[model samples]
Structures are given as C-alpha cells and as structure tokens.
Target: MHLHYLGHLPPDDPLDGYLRFDIAPQLGVHRTPSGFRVFQFDFCRDVYLYEELGGAFRVVGKFFPPGRRMAPGLVRPPTETEFQNLTYLHRLGLNNGSFRITRPLGYNPWLHCVLVVDHFDGQPLGEVIHQAIRQDRRNRLFRKLSALAEFLAVLHNRTAGDWTVDFSHPYDYNGRLIESLVEKRGMARSEAEEFYHLRENWRARTCMWEDRRVLVHGDATPSNFKVGPGREVMVFDLERMAWADRVFDLGRLAGELKHFFLQETGDPWAAEPFIGHFLWEYCGYFPDRRDAFRSITRRIPYYLGITLLRIARNAWVDWNYRRRLLEEAKQNLRAIP
Candidate 1:
C-alpha cells in the first residue's frame, strides 16, 4: 500500500492542541505530544502523536469532500454519523474481541470536518486475499473467510432489531448504479433497461422480505476489514452502516470473493467453495443453521448481483473485465427463478 507522510505539523497547527488536550487524557497520556506525524492513505489521513515521555498514539482522521451532501433532511453529517456509529458499536461490547471496531476519539468540525478514531493495526483483508490468490494458499483464505463470517454474524445477531427492512433502498440503489453505467458509456441503454427488469424481478421475490432487519456493515468490501496475525477481524468505515437484511453484508462479500477470483485466477467458479464455506459458517451462528442457510442463499443472488453491478460501474476497472462482471451479475439475477 502506498502511504505518503506529510511530515510533522507546526506548533501553531490547531490539531496539536486537539490531540494534546482532548485525546491525550482519554489515552491516559499526561504530557503534550511533541508532534504529530501525518500519513495520507487512500481515503483518510493517519496522525501518529509522540510524546517526549515515550507515550505514542495513532489516530485516523477522515475529511468529507467539499459539496458532499447527505440525503435531503438527513440530520447528521457523515463525520458525526460515523463517530456515533463507532461509539454505539463500541458500547455494544465490540470494543474488544475477535470482532471489533476502532474506537472513536472525537470529531473536529473546524479541522475540515475531520472524524478521528483510534488506529487499527493489521493488514487490509484485500491484500491478504491477493496474497492468498498469488501464493495458492486456499487454506489460509478459508481461515480468514471463517473469521470474517463469524465477526459479521456476531455484529448482525447482536444488533438485530424490530425495525422493518427497507427493501426499496436496494432497488433504488441498483437502478441508480445502472443509470450511472449508462451515463458513463460503460453500458448501453438497452443493457441498462434489461438490468432494470432483472432488478424488478428480484424485488418481486418473497425471499427478500423473509429476514428481519439487522445492523449491516453496509459496505462489506474486503478493503474495509483488517486481519490481525491470529486472523482476528476489525471492520471499519462505518459511515455507511445501517439496518438491513443480514445477507446484504454476506452477499456483498460473496460477490467480492467471486470478483477477486475471476480477476486473479481467470476462473469464476474457483470462488464457489470459499463462498459456500463463508455462507455456511455465517449460518452456523444462528439457531437453525439449515433454515438460515436456505433463507440467506435464496436472498444472496439479489445483493450479489447488485454488488457485481456496483463494481462493474467503476471506470477504473478494465472495460472487458467490467463486461465480465455485468455478465456474471446477470447470471446471478437470472438464477433467482
């Protein structure tokens, strides 16, 4: 991973006081940090604060892009939402365990609306997956998948609520993705229309409404999870976290597994065993494993198809590869009947 260090901030920088006064006490560091070493990552900047007394701390800060607006009338901005979500999850006993989230330190609206949280130590699961594929380490991949499945199960099961599942969001999201592909000239109008019909068909499936609403990771991409030395998983990027079908997370992960295998090994079917193992492992956490497996599998195609379309719409992906993703998405949607 490429990381660019921006060097230590000057003494007059406001972040210095924020760290010294606000964050230091929470971390039990008595003295002010001498300086902060800032490193820019793909989506956020990590600041490492060091004190003369040998106290050191790592905190991640994310800034929202200018003109980025939430849905109309939404109360909280992205930074506040993420901070609250992290705090909520931390209070739910996810602060320490095999499955946990990074601790939220504080949000600084004056500092570019930055949302800060404790830094998590581990490798992104995306890199782990790439290594497994390159090294032919199927066992290692399976173990990591198992750990992720367990973590997700605990997250969903522990936070399941009585709220009704909002199936419209997925339908609208899939439609918007198709429209974006058409606008980008990545897909033809006819292809987009056909995908729309497929989405409608998926919406009509009763299985989509069979499960209760649960707190889903909302963005279950491999890059959002960190894997420690013991295969422990720490999921972050909670800005999109919300209540939805538990399979929403699972199917996205399954689709990603398929995408990675196709991109790396040139075989779509190569991911089947790992996907099956992941879903089976997720179901193991529920009371009726057989029933849960059947229900989750039946609903997986919709979210999985949506995930494939989501990836296919990205301009960075090769055109031919995006076409393959579109075809795979169609196949999954068509298999629902």
Candidate 2:
C-alpha cells in the first residue's frame, strides 16, 4: 500500500486536535525501523493505527485515494460525490445487522479525504478457503456462507432503491466491464461484437426482473471477506458498493468460487458443488425460495460472464487461462435464457 506520509507520531502530525487527543494514548513512543507508522490497508487507501502506550491496537486514521491507478499509467480520481458515497456506505455497514464490519468512527472531508474507523480482526476468507479442508472445516465454511447470505439479505433489504443508473452511477460500474472485455482483454472486434450482442440479448431477457434495485457489494471476491470464530462474516472495501441488481454480487461471488476451486484443483468440475450450495444457501433467504432460485439461475450467468471477463483482463493470468476465461464467458452468455 502506497501511503502518503503526512507526519511522524508526536510533533509532525497533521491530524486534527480531537483525533490526535483521541489516539494520544495509543500513539507509540517511537516509529518502526522503516519509518513506517501505519498498518496494512489497501493499495489505494492509507490506514493508520495507534498501538497504545500499553499494547492495545486501534485504527485511528484512514486516507482514501483521490485517484486510483487503474493501468500502468492510467490514474482515475473520484469525484466529490463518489468519495462521500464510500463513507456513507461504510456507515451503513457499521450500523446494520449481525454482520461484522469495521465501525465508522469519523470522517474528515477537508481534502475530501480521510475516513476513520475501528479496526476489525478476523481470518480472511480467501486464506481460510485456500487452506487444507477437513469435514469440520467444510461444515464451518457452510455456516459462514449462511451467515454471509443473511447479511447480504439485510443490506439489500435496508437500502433497496430506484437509483438512476446514468445519474447516480458513480463508478461507471457496468460499462467498465464491457471496456475490460474489449480494451483490456484484447478480444477481437468480431468476437467483441458477438459478446455485446449476447450481453444485450441476456439483458433484454431479464430486464423485467422484479427484484428491487438494492445496494450490492459490487466486488464480492473472497479476499474482500473475513470469517470470525463463530463463522461470522465481515466484509471490507466498500468503494464498489452500489445500488444495482443484487445478482451482480451473487454472480461475482459464484465466479470467484469457481475461479478459486479451478486454481486449486486444476479442474473446473470441482467448483460446481460449492457453487450450487452457495446459491442454494443464498436463495434460502427469500420467502419464495423456488421462484427466487429460478430467478437467480436465469440472471447469474450474465453477471458470471461479466466476472469471468473481468478476471480475464488481469495481467497475472497467463495467455492460455485468459483464453479459457473468455471462452467460459462466451459459454455463459450463450447459455443465458
């Protein structure tokens, strides 16, 4: 994480007086060897912690990126509304339900930056999934999935709205997926046209989906979630949260589940059972499970294709695998009915 070093611990601190006083007890007497004063946040955000004169650790400060580096040289800065939206989303997460999340303590909008939140401690779901699995671990995983589904249901129910796509859309969220397929993934013109045609067909087919527009955890990769002792799930990285089709999240998760299992066993088939179980658990939240299950089944393939295409654009994926992802996306689009 590239952090903008505002100041040192004691004197050079640019923090507001109230924040400084709040964290004064937790400020260490000295800095680390590398002059590093903060803990691991994320690539685009800066997270600062205060380990008290005693030993307790608490997150006191966070600086969100004015601009994010998308490609090697491309930097995208968020608008004022976009930045404020993130803080509001975090507040919503902190206030809602049995789901665990970083508690929003405060916000500093002077530079249109800085959000303060309480640090949360838990095992990253990605690491837990990557580890060796036993029967006990499997059962625990199922429990966590159930909790996650319930949590998402709560979030969706709380924030459902008719947010206009072109007006309120902060991220250019869905359009970027199309951009990735063509520009980033290097799909042939004809292939890209066919992909767009298929996407439009699928969209036209399900455009009448009755599910209310709700806040979706736009990025649902395993790394964004953590599981605690009681199998409680905590999610972070809310910059992608948006009011859209909830299926966007469900499909992204399913795509990630498939991707992870495929990477682990080198067999696409290994993901099928887990994917089915996850979808089943998620559908259990709706009163009409059969209708919900059928609706999700119809819609998921489209978003899953979007997820697969997005993954294909990643630089780390080798040529052959990228081709596979593109192929899978096509298969998904073709299967949509």
Of the candidates shown, which would achieve the greatest TM-score relative to the real structure? 1
Least accurate 10 contiguous residues by lDDT in model 2 = 164-173
What is the lDDT for 127 in model 1?
A: 84
What Cα-based lDDT does every candidate model obtain? 0.83, 0.64
Residues 48-119 of candidate 2: C-alpha lDDT, one tens digit per residue: 664333344456455655454434422333333334555676666544445766555556556336666555
Q: What is candidate 2's local distance difference test score?
A: 0.64
Residues 84-183, candidate 1: write the lDDT tens digits.
Answer: 8999998889767677688888998787677877777788888878887898877888899999999898889999888767788888888888898899
Compute each candidate's TM-score over C-alphas: 0.94, 0.78
Pairing residues by index, what is the TM-score of model 2?
0.78
Instruction: List, in order, the clash count of every candidate structure.
Output: 0, 1
